[model samples]
Every structure is written in C-alpha cells, then in structure tokens.
Target: MGKKTTHKFKAEVSQLLDILVHSLYTNKEIFLRELISNASDALEKARFKGQAEGAEDTVAPEIRIACDADAGTLTITDTGVGMTRDELMRNIGTIAHSGTAELTRLAGEGKESLDALIGRFGVGFYSVYMVADEVEVTTRSIEPDAKPVVWTSDGRTDYKLQELDEDLPRGTKIVVRLKEDLASQFTNAAHLKHIVNKHSNFINFPIYVGDERVNTIQALWREPKFQITSEQYAEFYKFLTFDPDDPFDTLHTSVDAPVQFNALMFIPKHGDDPFGMGRENRGLDLYVRRVLIEKQNKDLLPEYLGFVKGVVDTEDLPLNISRETLQDNILMRKISSTLVKQVLDHLAKMAKDDADRYADFWRAHGELFKAGYMDFLNKDKFAGLVRFHSSGLEDEKGLTSFADYITRAKEDQKEIYYAYGPSREALNLSPHLEVFRRKGVEVLYLFEPIDEFVMDALSEFDGWSLVSAEHADPAKLDKFESLEAEDKPEPLSDTEKPVLDKLLARMKDALGDAVTEVKASARLSRSPVCLANPDGNVTSSMDKIMRVMSKDSSIPKKILEVNPDHPLVRNMLTILERDENDPFIEQAANQLYESALLLEGYLTDPHALVGRVQDLLTKSSGWYVASEK
Candidate 1:
C-alpha cells in the first residue's frame, strides 16, 4: 500500500457541490444519467486511444451496473482508460485549470461560447452527490506499470486519495452508498434498467444491469446512411414512433461545420391531425453524444413540423447542468434553421422526382403545410408545396401547385385567379366561374375555410396577385375573348335599353339592402342572374367565413348582375315597362334576386325564399287557367 493523502476541494468545487446538493433540488434522478454519460465518454476516449496505440481490443468495452438492495449501494463499472493518481487528485480535488467558476460567471453574463465550454468541463461527476452521501472510485491506468488508485469523497469539503493494495484492471469502478431515504428509491434493478435504457440506450458500448444486457438497438442516426437497410430503417421508425405504417419519407443527414448534428427524421404515412390542432407542442428527441438529453424537445423544431417524428443527435448542443434543457438558444436556432432547410430540401427533391408519391404525401399533409403559410421566412419555399383543385382539370384526383399554375397561366393573365367555397363541387358549380369558363381561363378552387387565410398569408405567388374569382370584376376577363363566341351577339336595341334600365332599377328597389348595385351582366352567358362582391371588397366566401366565425346574423350586400338575353329577365323587363306595379312583376323580380342569393351560398333563411316560390307558383297557376279558358 502507498501513502494516503487527504486533499481539500478547490473553492469552486465546494461551491458547485453546495448548489447540487441544496440549491438545485430538481431532477435528482438525473444523477444516474450524468454518471452513465460520463462512463460513455470515458469509454469513447479509451477506444480512440487504443486505436491510436494499435492495441488489438485488449478488453471488450462495456458498462455494468449492479444494485445492492441489502447493502444500500449502487455500483457502476466501465472498462475505460482509467486515470493515474496525479490525474485523479487534480481532476477530482481541484477546479482551477477547468475554471468552472469562470464558466459559471460567464454563463450568468450570457456569454454564448462559455455555455458550450461549461458542458465540456467534466463537472458532471459531482452530480452523484445529489443521491449518495458518500462515493468511492477505484481505477487503474492502461499504462503497463502504473499503480492503481482509490479516491474517496463525501462531496462536502475534501476528498482522500490512496494507492490500492493490489494491481487492478485497466478501467474504473464507482460504488455509491445511498442516503437512507434515497436507498429504496434507486436500489431496484427494474428502475435502474429503466434509467439506463432511457438515457444511455444509444451508447456505443454494451450496458449490463446485473447479468442482463440492455441498450440493444444501435443509434442508427449516427451511422452512415449507406450502412442501414430499408427493413432496419422501418423497424427503427416503428420503435421511435410506434407507427405501423411505413414512413412516406425519410431524411437522414449529418452536418459538420457551423453545427455538428446527425438527424434521422420520418414523415409518417398519416399525421394525427393534418389540419390545425391549436398550437400543440411537439418535436423530436434531442441527444448529445448518444445520451438522450431531452425527450419531445419542442425547441429543436417549430410547431409547424409537429407531425414529424425522429431523433436528432448533436455533439454541439450546449446543455444545462442537469442536461434537462438547452442553454444556448442562439445556437439552437442555428441548428433548427439548418434542420428545417434540410427537411424542406429533401421534400422538394421528393416533389420533383416522385410526383405520385409526393401527391400521396401531400393529400395527407397538405393542410398542415398550409399552417406554414404565415411563416414569412419560409413562405416562398412552402408555396411550392401548396396544392389545389383547378378548373383546368377535368377531375379532382390531381392537384395543381402555384408553380404549376404559373406555368399554365395565360400570357396576359396578370393575376392568379382562385375561388373559395365549402367544397370542390360547390366551387366548381359557382356562377362566379361563368366568365372564366367561357373564356377558357383556369381558376384554382379552394375548399377549406382556412384556405382563405392561407392565400392571404401568401398574398401573391411569383409576382402575380391572388384574386378570388368571386371578387373578380367581369372587366378583368375582357382581355381574353370567349373562345366559343367568336362572333359577338347583337347588342340590346337602343329603344329596349330604356326598358332594361327601368327593369334593373325596379329589381334593385325590390331587393333593398341585399343588392349593392344592379347592372347588366357581361359575365353571365347562361345563368339569368348571379351575385358578386363589389370591386376591392371581400368575396362572398370570405363574408360567409367571417359571419360563421363571429356568429353574426347579417349578410353582406353583393352586386346583382342580370343577363338581359335570358327569357326570365326579358319577360320581367316587358312587365316593368307595361305596368311597373304588376304584382307578378314584383314577385318575378324578387324571385330572381333570391335565386341569386341562394346560388351565392348567402341565403340562410329558406322560409322567405320558400314562401316567394309558392306565391310565384300560385300566380303561374292563375295565369295558366286564364290562358286555358
């Protein structure tokens, strides 16, 4: 046996211990996590040194944990590059060289770099004091002739170092005598296995709790992409996400400079709710050097990507002392920004290379992607992922993106036209689309109520303003001639214009506040009448959405357009010119306006419309009897 020396802890070491034992009371269970992480780090260093020295796997690297319920003790053993006597005394009893105090002071000052330095300072070993009253460490160096040493500390003020009586193996072992109150909490084999698997499951070396081995699965994210198989990837994804369906997409990448990170992310075949879920917090698991630091870490990704499931292992993340939360937010943002870009880039590639698969993904996740419409920083990129039912397509099976719309737009089409309705079928049948259909101009159909907000968020795509078809003026389509109507029809006769004007004015008077302005229709080639929003005003779809949201009963006014060529309107004009007060004339005019209101999806109370239709039928019966007699 060699001489035993008792040494006092550096002032900073004492101060740090004081905080761990008393001031910092949370995450006491993290002591196991910290110790396991330290063991893993030591194992990693030993493996690297063994490779450098051309040592041929002297002893298989592993970590073993044994819990002694009767003895009230927990011991962790690691076959790592053990430290020498001088190294142990300097590393355990002193903190001058590491300057943990300066790091703490700098952390208080909000110095970003010092936060990372603190993580690398190796002060995590002291966290054992949180659970144990006394700790003993026995170690022997890998050097052939170095003597073994034992270090003992109560983690209060000072520690003792002494040489072991006999030679020991090239590794370190720590035995912790738990406090009486804390003994029952941690001495169980099951609880220790849970902690080991929770935090250290990805450690490079095998970990054994008693005789059984834990941490069986490899950290595939840290491995090169080429080395993993599709079946393995699927299994890993199932393990991480508990999802049975194969992932629609996978993004595996490793970044070196600026930030060091390895990410293996998966987009599930379907999400929990593709539509809005009301700001639910969700994100990926975060790990540092194979040890999990935060599970479900929301800071690693924005809420827009909550549906994504995967793991992000980075060596550069600066963690707090407990490794529970991140320390440097600015650094986190940099990593997050890079991750977001990579994910988007991978999606863009999928969109470009695989239309069928991408379409499937889009059909499931398109609405969620719309949530990113307000993310100005990524709006342009996100726009490429937007899909909508288009008038140009015969069926709704295929969806068109804004980029596709721009490519197919007419040369003089100054605006990107879209129409919002409750469903694709409603938007398809909307009378507002008459002019576009006549002129062969395509209009995008938006179905969801939130689609309006999404369009407003994007505002414009490729320098072309997004104009709702319901709100578009007939004049906008004047540039494109109606392809079917090559020869224009005769205009309304000069003398008949007076009668048409009187009929329009009378119809406007009958409708009262409902009609903003009554005018001849240039848009309608088939329908008798239709309602449209006045120029520079909200579309009927927008009005309906607002009314429903606010629970308001009042409906907004819309311009009334009359097709003079239609037989119904011609008959009404004749009645107005002959006898403006004719009861049937008023009934016909009112019916015409109500039908337009119904078509616009704004007429909620059907009683008034039903009553008017019955009156018109009764009057028609009276007219038919008179004619038959």
Candidate 2:
C-alpha cells in the first residue's frame, strides 16, 4: 500500500533547511556530490560494520544515478546501508551539530556566507536546493522493525516525513525534481557524464551515470609503494601525462607533518610537458585519498620544474571540494613546500647513486637546474645538484660537480672563468676563450641557456667570482703572462699613430650610436678585434632577445678592442700605410667591425656584410684598380 502525508519540521529543522538552501554560494552545485559523498560515507560505515561482525559484504559496492530528462526528475540511488525512521529524523531533520543554533543565527543575519557553513553541520544533503526545487528520499532499513520511509523537502523553511510499506530491500533512494529552468542539466546525457567525470572520477565504487559506470580510474596513487611495480608506476605516469615515454624518476612519500599527506611525484623522461603546444612545462597532479583533485597544480612547484608529472594525496583535504585555488590555503602551502623538497631530495639521491642516469637527466634538464640556481628560494639546493662538462677535466661520462670545480681552481685564479655558449666545442673555439686559455686557467664550460642567469645570480661560488670567459681582462695573468708583457714589443710608431687616429675618427662617425669607442687592442692576442659592453648590464644574448622580443630597432653600443699583435690587424696597419687617402679604408674598417661582431655573438646584418665583402673583392681583384700595373 502507498500513502502521502506531511508533518511540520522541528523549529531547529526549519532553520537548518533554510541555511542549507541558501548558504552555499559558489559551491551550490556540489549538493549532488555532497549527497553522493554522504551516501559513500554511509556505505563505508556499513561495510566497516559488516567487516567488524565478520559477515560477507554481499551488496554490490557502487553508487549509481538514473536520470529521467522527460520526467524532469533525477533519482540518485545507492545500495548502501539504508536508514530507518529515527535515523532519518535525527540525521536529516534535526541537523546533527553542536553549534547549530549559533550557526543558524549567524547565517540568518547574513553576516556569514553559507558556503562554508553548509557541509560543516551535516547540511551536505541540503545542497539539493541549489538545483532542485523539491527532493524526496525513499529508504528502507536493515533493522527488523524497518519500514520504507519518505522524507520530502522543498529545501526552504520546512520538510515532511511519512512511513510506507514497500519492497525497497535495504538501501537509500533520492529523487530530485529539477527546477523547471535548470532541467536541461539532468536531461542531457552528456552533462551528467561531464559532472560525474569532473567531480567523482575515483569514488570508492562504480559511479554509473545513465547505464554505464563513468569512472574507471583506479586512483592508483593510494596504493602502497611496495605493492606498486616499476611498470605500474610508469603506466600511471603515462596516463597522467598522456606521454608514451616512461618517467625518468619517481618519488612516492606519505607524510603526516604539520599536515597529513600522501604524495606520488615523478619527473618524466623528457624534460618538458607538452600541453599540445611545442612549449615545455611541469605536469604535476594533486589528489586526495583515491579521488583526483587538481589535474594540474602549478603552485605546488616552481615553473622551471614544469617537467614534473605525478600525483599527491592528502587526507586533510575535505575531498568534497575545488583544489584549483589550493595554494592559498595553509594546508596546501605545507604540502607544496614539502613535496617540492621531497622531489629535490630524490634527485640528489639519483646524483649520488646513479651518476649515469642523473647525467642523462642533467643533459636534458640542465637549463631547469640552472634556473633553480637563479631563483633565490631554490638556489642553495639546486646549486649543489648542478652538473657541468668541464674543459680542463676529461669528458668521459660523469658530469663535473661544482664541488669538483672548486677543487680544480687554479693557484692564482682569482675567479672561476666560465664560458657559456651553445656547446663546449663552440665555447672552446670562441675568440673569447683565448685569454683564459693563455692564462692556463680552467674555465667552466656552460652550454645550457640558463647557465648565464645562474652565474649572474650566483655572482660568486666557493669564494670565487663567476667570471664570464668573454669579459674583458685576463686580470690575474701572472700565472701565464707576466706584468712585464703589458709593454709592447715595439711602440705605436709615429706613422702608425696618425693612421690609428684617422681610423678611430672614421669609425666613431660610421658606427655612430652603435659603439662607445673603437680602441686599440690590449686584451686581444690571436684575434683581430673583440666587442665588449661598456655598461655590462645584462648578457649579450639576453639583450638581443629583449631587442627582438620588443621589436626595438635601436642598436646597442659596444666597445671594440683590436689585437695590436694579430696578423689581421698588422695587415690592416700595412694597408693604412699605403693609403692615408685610401678609398678601400672604409671597406676594410667595416669588414673588421663585422668580424668582431660575429666573434662577440652579436647579430651582424648579412646583406651589409656581403656588400662590404663584395667591395673588398672589387678593390683587391683589380675591378676598381686604376692601371693594375
């Protein structure tokens, strides 16, 4: 038989219903998930009780949602341990809480927002008002005196309850009458599927929307590290990043510190996360218990580490919420800091135990390591982990640690000479390395892009300045070249002096606004000329990137230093001797300037350089020569 009836809610119950309806502002839609959460909690409790009594759990352990879009109703039924009449009255009606009256008063005065207060007092079930105009709960108890009970509420001022005789075995069924305006959310199959995936992808049981269980993820982060194999971890990493490439490293840690947490973090084999773009980044995920929380949590780690891909689980999280904005919360901040350090420690361990593997990682992510060296917060730790290919030492397999670099510092090497370019071969071939090699100093070969930034940030390492190889001055040259060598083998001749003066004057005019001065060489030994920044603010590469990025046309000024002893400079000196009024002088000067610019790693416009070379050929090949004889 069936009957319909109504009864007035208790005074507390009416106020509770009011708060539940309007309290949750932004998180209103969570009412469905909250109800599902409570249902799961009930089922878990029931399962625990059954386990305690040593009885087999025969009920299929899953939560299912059936939608009737045409009927304008959605029923969320669970085969969980159902509630009896008194359980409903006490759990649902009275609003189980200790500070219920105070919260109700605080909420009614509108002084406090309802979102925070909703699930705090078992009002998770009331979230239905966020979407539904009315809800009816039909449940049957497992108790001997159990009977089917119906509790109905419009989610406003009051609710009603009644008993009925039916064959609803032993579970809870909640039928929601969608608000007329929002009925489409329940009716459309896709929307229901989206909601299930977004919020409850890893519920303890199969979460069926319509007919099929939408959640298939095993929530593998919760598994014990010993139980998980390398293949399993790699599989999960690929699934997390969608990268067929296996991870280079994995770190799984469970901490119950200032805040409790279980984190499984990995650094992918490739040093970048491909977000469909060619650009690289860190890919780290955050979860709570077995449910995925935030798929991409950037704040937990720094950007240079964008290559990290993994999951973190914490019990402290309400798990019933949005983790996008988790970093601001105190709990998340602790987890973020702790997890980053844990991964770093793992990397350090790799360096100590597996040099070959760590070298592979270094070869790929050396830029990121250098970036960490630049960031003030991560510097000390990242610096210790930096590995580089050294020039003085043999390049076999292992990377040269900065500690080893310190041990190899020269007797009079005032600072650590470092050459940062595209490669060890390139830096070694550079004109900039002449003085360092002449001085018999071991310059650290830095090929990574972030190396310059790290050296600039570090400034000094192990009490020695990080001197760029290109920087002017072979300062402490006593070890190789003595102070007596500053004396020229021969003085600047009176005849050559006038040529130098004229050459400098014409250069100042031709390269106006592009060079501070065209000085005679002092630092140059083998090269004809070299360029240096007068101000020496940022690195040349960074300056060029800035000029191009900003599309600025203003040419940066540079100081030009000629090697007085070089064969090219001597040839130019000889040419100037014949031509005080030489028409080819301008072409000769341009060629020398362009050559210096190329050596300095600055961009020299190719068209003008080609024209200058063509003019040189025209003059040398008798094309512009008057009477070749």
Candidate 3:
C-alpha cells in the first residue's frame, strides 16, 4: 500500500452525517435503496461513456450483493465506472457534490443518454452509516495507468485514503460492518433480497444476491406503447396493485412538454374503499429513474383522483437530501397537471368509442369521480365525463352525460334542472316534479348526498346553469307550452277566490313558523302541496347532510306552495268558508305541510303523520259504511 493520508470531512458533511445516521430517513432499509441507486447511476455513466468513445467492451454490467451472517457484514459490488483518487476526494470528501450531476453538466448536449443517471445529491453514500458502524470503499478506475484506491471511514470526523499497488477490475465495491442492533436484520441473504426487490426491482441492470438473481421485473412504463402487449400490461397491473381482477382501464402515457415523465396508471375494477369508511391510502408510487423514492405519494395527484393507482417515473423532480421528501412542489404540480389531463383525455376517448365500457367505468368510479367538480381548472373535461340518471331515462340504472342532456334539452331551455330524492321511485312521486313532467323537460336525479355538493360546486356547465327542479323559476317555466293535453279541472272560480284566500291565511296560521310562506303554486298540476327554499341559500339535500353532521334534528323552515286546482285544496277552501274556526281545516293543512317535509327528507317525526292519516281514514270509512247501510 502507498502512503496513507487522513482528511477531515467538510464541516457541513459532518453535520449531515449525524443527521443521516440518526433521523434523516424514517426507515433504516432506505440505506440499501440509496446505495443501490448510486450503483445504478455509475453503471449508466459507464455505458454512456462507452457509446461515446466507440469502445467495444467485453464485460457485462451488473450488481452483486453478498451477506456474511456470522461475521455481521454485508457487501455490495458493482461492475461500473469507478472513481480515481482525486475523483473520490471530490465525490465523497465534500457534501452534496454529485459526480452524476457534474458529468451531465460537463457533457451538456453531447451525451443524450446521461439523463438515465440517478444520483443528483452526493449524500446518498453516507446513508450507509445509518445501518453500518464503518464503511470501506475499494475502487479501480477504467482510465489507463490509474491505480486502485481504498477509502475507509467510520462516518465520523475523518477518513483515510490510500493508493494500492495491486491491479483490480474496473468497478466499485463497498463493505459495511453492520451496527450491533441492526446486524441480524440486514446480515441475512433473504432479508437483503427482500430489500432489493422492494426498492430496486425495476432498475435497468440485473441484480444478484449470492447465486440467485433479484430485480427481475422490468420497468415497462419506460418502454414504447407499441412494444407492450395486453397480457404484459395485465400482469404488471396485478403485480403493482395485487388486484386479482383486471383493471377497468389502463392509461400509459409519456409527456415531454412542461415536464418529462412516463406513467402507467390504472383505473381499478372496484374501489378499495367504496363506502369510504376512513381516509383511503391514495397516490401513485413515485420513482426517479426506476428507483422508488416515495411510495403512495399523495402530492402527485389530488385527493379526488386518489382512486387511480400505478407508478410515475420522472427525471424532472428534485429530491431533498434524504430522498424521502420532494424538494420542489412546483415541478410536482406541473407533473400532476399533465397527469390529470392525460387521465381525463383517456376517459373521454373511452366515452366516445365504447359506450358500454364507459358506463361500467362510470358505475364503478362515478361516486368518487364526481368530487372532481371542484377541480375548476379542468371543469370542461370533468363536465364532459359526469353521468347522471335523468327523468328522461326509463329506469334508475339508465345514465346520461351532461353533454347528452344538453343535446336533448328544449330549444328555449336555459337551465339544466336536477332534483334530489332517496330513490328514483320516490323522485317520481315528488310534488316538485309536476311542472317539469308537464313541460316535457328532463331533470337529473341526484341520489347520493355528495351529488348535491358536486352539482353545487359545478353550478353551471356548457353555459347552462344547473338549477334544482325544486328551485326552478315559475315564470321561465310558464313560457313552455304544457305537453299535457287533458286538463279539465278549472281553477277556483272568480267568486270563490276570496274563500281560497281565507283558507291560505288559515293554513299559514296553523303551520305558523314551520313555513316561510304559504301561497298558491301555479307550477303544480297533480300534487296538492310542495316545499321550496325561499332564499335558495342551501339545497335541501345539503341541508339534511349538514343537519346530520351537526346532530340537529329540527326541520328546516321552507315556503309551502299549494295548488289551487287540486281537489284537496278546493275542498279545504269550502270547509274554511263554512266554519272559519273548523278544526278539520287546520288538521288537513298541517298534514299537507308534514307530507311535503317527508319528501324533502327533513321530517324528524313520523308519529304525527301516521296519526293524521289514520284519522282521515277512520272518518272516510265511517262515511262509507253509513252510505252502504
């Protein structure tokens, strides 16, 4: 051995080493990932240089990992371009000095494949200290006349470097003496293989642990779309998500503008948490040059798109020293913007090409996808993808998109109407739908409580306001001729108008503050009464959801609109005229108010409603028996 020299680590490097050994990474196994990534980078550099120099190399590039359980030591060796004495001093002696980054800078545009290099921060090698008491690096450069060098360090204040007289192969080898507490965990070959498979399985180079080859999986996302087969995609999806069923659809995309990244995303056949019991773990596995940097990185996609799964590998992202967290959020947002666009574009194509398959996707993910209404930046795309069951459809299972609804809308229609109910059958019975049914207009049916929030967030689409059927303007609806041909029931005669007015006053008095207003409803044709939000500050569905969340059971006050032409309303007017203090008129009025509340899902007590129905039934039955006798 040549004369040895002792050198102190950079002041900042010493501080960084302390952090790396203690708390820089949440998982101790991350040390293995970082070291493997560095090795991959070096191999890539060597391959790029060989291509540039037109050199015919004979050796195959690979990484080898060996464990000595009894000795409590693990060794990793790579057949890649190694470092010289001066190069080692510059790369390892200083902090945050990346050889890969320097080579890229020096090569500039001459080396196109240098983008595959992974290590951007020089601190990755020091992470070995996280699991090792001491590290030894023995390397021989490919440069002619370059002697082998040995670097020894305890990862503390100082390290020793010496030149070796003997010739060695052109590559790098690192041996780690495991710390006492962590020795058993890392010294076994099986455990080391598991670590290699978890983090570096997709690395371009082959990896070996003893006689067995690990990292057998390919980075299929980096391959061209035309070269990949359907079977391969399905197999890869299963491996990535562990979902037994095939994916509903796959979105394999490569973007170049704004940022460059390759992504393989899948829309699962069914959501992992369809009921949303708790916050689901979401986001894609983020990779940098095929090395796993962050798993389930929520920052890569918005919460609404959490149902999507797969991997995203980008060279544009800047990682902090630990590589566990992202250094720049702006680049992440750019990548996210591109991803959202790609996903929406794929769905749009499916919707246009295969209606049945698109419908299946809607059924599987619509509940969660509807939340994308808040993504206003992609509002047009989101609107094009939303599907709803409409009054025009024959059944609840039938679906239509907003674009289709607009196409079917009447020429004079300016607002897209929707209504909320517990079910389609219940909505058919809604008093609020009488006018919409009469006008031959379609109304979207909102079943889930979140549907109300989605519509409210959207408010409008394709220049048409999304107005609730219950909140439709009476005057605008009157412009459309009634499609119903049979209408013989005359409105209250001119002389009886005063009686109707008195009945309205009496009913208002009976309901008291339960109603904001009680007036004749011109929009009603079949039902006697219906409720409306006077201020329109909150939709009835949202009101109920808020009430449930806040634990408030009181019914919300709303306007009560009575149809004058209905038989029940006409009879109530006669009863009020005969006896202004009649108890039956007050009871009937209260019953109508409670019935309307039930339709709005706000009625807290059904006992009073049940008793009123029974009272009316008893009186009617008694009259029927007397007539029969």
Candidate 4:
C-alpha cells in the first residue's frame, strides 16, 4: 500500500462542513437519503458506460446497506463507477470540486444566486458527517489496472487518503461510525428500511438492507407509455391515490427539449372533495432521477390541478444542498407550466375522442376542475374543457362545452349566454331562462357559487363575450328577430298601455329603493316577474357571491321586469285600476317584487316574504269563499 497522505480542507470547506454537521439540515435522518441518492447516481453512470463499452458482465450494479449496532457502524455499498486516486483527491479533498467557496459567496450575497449553487454544486457527500463521527470511503475505477483508493475523514479540517485492499470490488463503499446516540437509530434495520423506502423506493436498481430488498416498487413514470399495461397503471393509480376504483384518465408524458422530465399523472374516477377543499395542496410527488425529493410537493403542480396525483421525475430540477426542497423557482415554474399544458391537452383530447369517459371525469372532478377556467395562464385552454348543462342539452348528464356552444349559437350571435342558479333543476325553473327557451337560444346553467367568478375571469371565449341571462337586455335579441311576430306580445296596445303604466307606477312606489325600475317585460314569455341586473357587468350570481363574502346583507337595487301578458300582472293592473289605495293591491305589488327577489337568490330574509305570501293566500281564499256564496 502507498504511504497514507493527509490533506487539509480549504478554510471555506471546513466552515461549511461544521455548519452542515451542526445546523444545515432540519432532519438528521436525511443523511441516509442523500448518501443513498448519490450512490444511485454513480451506479447509473456506471451502467451507462458499461452498455457503451460492452462490459456489462464486469459487475452487477446494486446498493447494499448493512448496519452493525455493536460496532457503531453503518456501511452502504454500491457497484458503481468509482473514482480514481486523483479523482478522489480532487472530488473530496479539495473545495473546488464541491463548490464550497462559491456557495459561501452566494450565501453571503443572499439567495439570488441560490439556484446556481444548488443546481451546480455537489456537496451532498459532506452531509454524512451530520450523523457520523467519522466516514470512510473505498473506491476502485472500472479500469482493470487501476488501484483501489480509500478516503477517510473525521469531518473537521482535514482528511486522509490511502490504498484499499487489492481484492476489493470495482465499486464504491462508504462506512460511517455513527455518534453514540445516533448509532442505535442508524443501526436499526427496520428504521433504515423506512428511510430508504420513503426517499428512494423507486430507484431503478435494487436496494437491499441486510438480505431483504426494500425498493420493490417500479418507477413507472420513467417507462415508455407503449409498454405499460392498463392494469399496471390502474394498480399504480390505486397505490398513489388510495382510490379503489380505476382512474378516469392517465397522462404519461416524457419531454426532453426545453426541460427534461417524465410525468405520470392520473385523474381519479372520483374526488375526495368535489366542490373544493378551500386550500391549495398539490398531490404530485417531485423526484430527481427516480429518488423522491419532495412528497406531495405543493410547488410541483398548480392548485387547480389538485385532484391529479402522481410522480414527476426529472434531472433538470435544481435541489438545495440538503436535497429536501427545490431551490429554483424559475425552473420549477417552467416544469409546472409544461405540466399544466400537457395535462390540459390530454383532457382536451379525451373530451374529443371519448365523450363517455370524459363525462365520467366531469362527474368526478368537474366541480373542482372549473377552477381552471379562471386560471390566467390557461383560461383559454380551460374554456374548451369546462362542461355545463345547457338549454340545448337539458339532461343533467348531457354537458356542453364552449366550443359546442359557439357551434350551436345563432348566426351573428356575438355573446354566449349563461344563467347561474342553485342547480340545473333550479335554473330550468328560473324565470330568466323563459325567453332563452322560447327563442331556441342555448344558455349555460351554472350551478356552483364559484361559477360566477369563473365566468368573470374568463369574460370571453372564442371571441364571444359571456353574457349572463339575468343581465342580458331583452332588446339585444330584437335585432336577431329570433322572437316570431306572434311570439312578441302585441307591443302594449294603445288602450292597455295606460293600465300597464299604472301597475308599473304602483310597483315602483311600493318597492321604493328595492328596485331601480319596474318595467314592462319584452323578454318574459311564461314567468310572471324576474329581476335583472341593470348593470350588465355584474351578474346576479356575481352579486350574490360578493354579498356573501363581504357579509353585506343589504340588497343592491335591481330592475324588476314584469311580464304584461301573465295573469298575475294583468290582474294586478285591473285591481289597481279599480282601487289605487286598496290594501290588497299594495300587498300584491310587494309580493311580486319579493318573489322576484327570491328567485334571483337575493332575498336575505324569507320571513317577510313568507308573511306576504300568507296574506295573499288568505285574501284569495276569502275572495273564493265570497264567490261560492
């Protein structure tokens, strides 16, 4: 053996080592994950080289971890492309290879250059000292004639290099003498197995602790889409999502040009919370070369895609020195943007290729998925993905997208009409949809509270504005001449106009500030009365949502449009003509306005409306008794 040589670590390296051992990492157990990950990378490099050189039989690449409690030692061995004597001196002995000085400079300058240091610097090996009192490494290069090299460090200011025994394998092995208290924890086979599985379960090669293999689960994300079976995907999805049913869709993608990554994402057949969970929690696991770096990483995917669960493996990620979290927000954003696009693209294709399966996805996650319609980055893309109950498809299961809506819209239709209500059933009964149904115009039924905000965010789709049915002006349809001449109420007859005017004036007086104006309705065909937001920009749905959030109980003034042809309004006109001061006429006018308010979901107190309704019923029942006598 050559004489052992000792080399002093650079001043900066020594300082970094002290910090890494005492305070750099939050969890001491992470030392095992870091070291094991490094070993996996080395083994991968060796395998690639062996394939190119046709020397595959030289050694079987595997990672074996052995713990000795009595000896206070934990050793990790891997058949990998080991470093030569000179390589060891430069890679570990000097600070240059580890980028210690650069890291220190960046840290002193603040975190602006953090990404540069974390992504380019290689200092994970030093983290072993966080738990170990001393660490020793034995390595032999793939070259047959190369001598084995051994490096030892007490993790202070210096390290020593010596030659290993000739019979040592052509790989690298690290032996750590754990600190007194940490020894027992590191030596426990079961404990170490857990750490391995938690951080490195999907590592390509087999990982063994003692004689038992721990990393049995395959990293399916790295595999080709063509080779994977649906059964395999279903099994993997169940494991990841904990959902017993099969996934509605699976998006497995591999990209290399801009940012290299492999993603295996799944849309579950059902969601844990269909509406929303009221928080942004990303279900995607972030991995580097198959070793999980962050599990359930919220930064990996956007909040809108919270329902998607899977793993994303990429070498392009820039991880901090601890390898616990990502350091590059710019790179992470790139990955997230790409993922959002890919996932949306897959959904769009699924929607087009298979309507039945797409409908299944819609039923499962559609409520939460509508959140994407407001995503600024993908609003237009999401426009095609959103599904809604429309006048054209009255069935609850028959949802129409904006694309279909545009296709079915009447010629020269400049706006896409939609109505917001408690549900499809409620929207079907809404007075606001009377004219839409009568004219054969399709209006989207928005059921959720968030749908209004989503529409406001989207504002427009495919060059057409999203106009709310409750806010749409009746005169806007006159140009389309969609309402047949017979369908249009004979424009207030010269003689009947005065009676209609009298009813409007009485209603306006009774409602006071409750209504901005009470007008004759050219839109209503079957309904007695309806409320419309005169300020077209604010839909009734939007107003209600704002009211709830701001805790504002005061109702905003709305235009009360009364259908002149309806029996209720015509009778009110006749009653008003007979006796303007009649108490029943006042009760009747107030009832009309309150009922409209209730239908618009703006009625704050139902108590008053209920009393008015009781009064009307009592008066009508008495009138019926008199008629019978």
Best by TM-score: 3
Question: Model 4 misses residue 304 by how many Å?
Answer: 1.7
Clashes of each: 0, 6, 0, 0
TM-score, one value per model = 0.89, 0.79, 0.93, 0.90
lDDT of each: 0.80, 0.71, 0.84, 0.80
Candidate 1 vs candidate 2: the TM-score winner is: 1
At residue 504, candidate 4 shows an lDDT of: 87
Ranking by TM-score: 3, 4, 1, 2
The model with the greater TM-score, 1 or 3, is 3
Give model 4 RMSD, 1 decimal: 3.2
lDDT of 1 by residue, 435-498 (tens): 8888889999888877888888888887988888866666778888777863344567999899
**What lDDT, from 0 to 1, does candidate 3 have?**
0.84
lDDT winner between 1 and 2, please give it. 1
What RMSD, rounded to one decimal, does every model reach?
3.7, 5.2, 5.4, 3.2
Number of the candidate with higher lDDT, 2 or 3:
3
Q: Residue 425 CA error for candidate 4 (Å)?
A: 3.1
- Give the worst 10-residue stretch by lDDT in candidate 3: 111-120
* Cα lDDT of model 4 by residue, 1-629, tens digit: 87799999887678666666656444677678778888888898898887898864667779999999999999999998888998888788655555556657755655433223334565667778888899999999877788899899999999999885677778899999998988999999999999998988998888999999999878888888899999999998887767889887788999885789999998877777643563554568888788777788777666777888899888876443232335355667788889888888888889899988888888888877877765787877888888888878857669888888999988878889988888777888888788787777889888787777778888898789998887776777756654554443445578878988887888888878878998988788788888878776777888888888999988889898888888777777778778887776677778878887777767778898798778778878999999999
The C-alpha local distance difference test score for the whole of candidate 1 amounts to 0.80
Model 4: lowest-lDDT 10 consecutive positions: 110-119
Runs in model 1 deviating more than 4 A are 23-26, 94-122, 274-281, 319-328, 483-490, 535-537, 547-553, 584-594, 622-629
Model 2 residue 299 CA deviation (Å) reads 2.4
